[model samples]
Target: MKPDIHPVSRPVVFRDRAAGVAFLTRSTAHSTRTIEWEDGAVHPLVDVEISSASHPFHTGTSRVLDTAGRVERFERRYGRTAPNRR
Candidate 1:
């Protein structure tokens, strides 16, 4: 380990604006904004537009693409042809 070479790591609050969720975690990221946490302590506030709470994948709201249907449509538009297996 080297002295005076490592970046400072501290607690930071990442707030999901859309989901209105905030969590405190240790990060090297710095922010000028601050917010009062649940523990009555103010930490660096980082505002984010998306997080696991509001993301479509995490929320199970993501749309599944119909690849099979798309292939059928393509075949209907243009007749299927054998692929070069060589």
Candidate 2:
């Protein structure tokens, strides 16, 4: 281990505004904003647009694309041709 070589990690508050959820975790990320946590401590606040709480995949709301159907449509539009041999 080296001395004073690692970036400082401190408690940071990641706020997911879309999900209205805030959690405290240690990170090297910095923010100009501050937030008062549930423990009555102030931590650097980072606003995130999406998180596991609000993400489509995490929330089980993501759509499964019909790749086979898309391939069929593309073949219909542009007739499927035989592979060219060298």
Q: What is the number of backbone collisions in each predicted candidate, taken in the order shown? A: 0, 0
Top candidate on TM-score is 1
lDDT of 1: 0.95
For model 1, residues 1-86, the per-residue Cα lDDT tens digits are: 98999999999999999999987999999899999988999899999999999999999999999999999999999989999898
How many residue pairs of model 2 clash at the backbone? 0
CA lDDT, every model vs. true structure = 0.95, 0.96
**Cα deviation of 82, candidate 1, in Å:** 8.0
The lDDT, on a scale of 0 to 1, for candidate 2 is 0.96
Which candidate leads the pack in lDDT? Answer: 2
RMSD of 1: 2.2
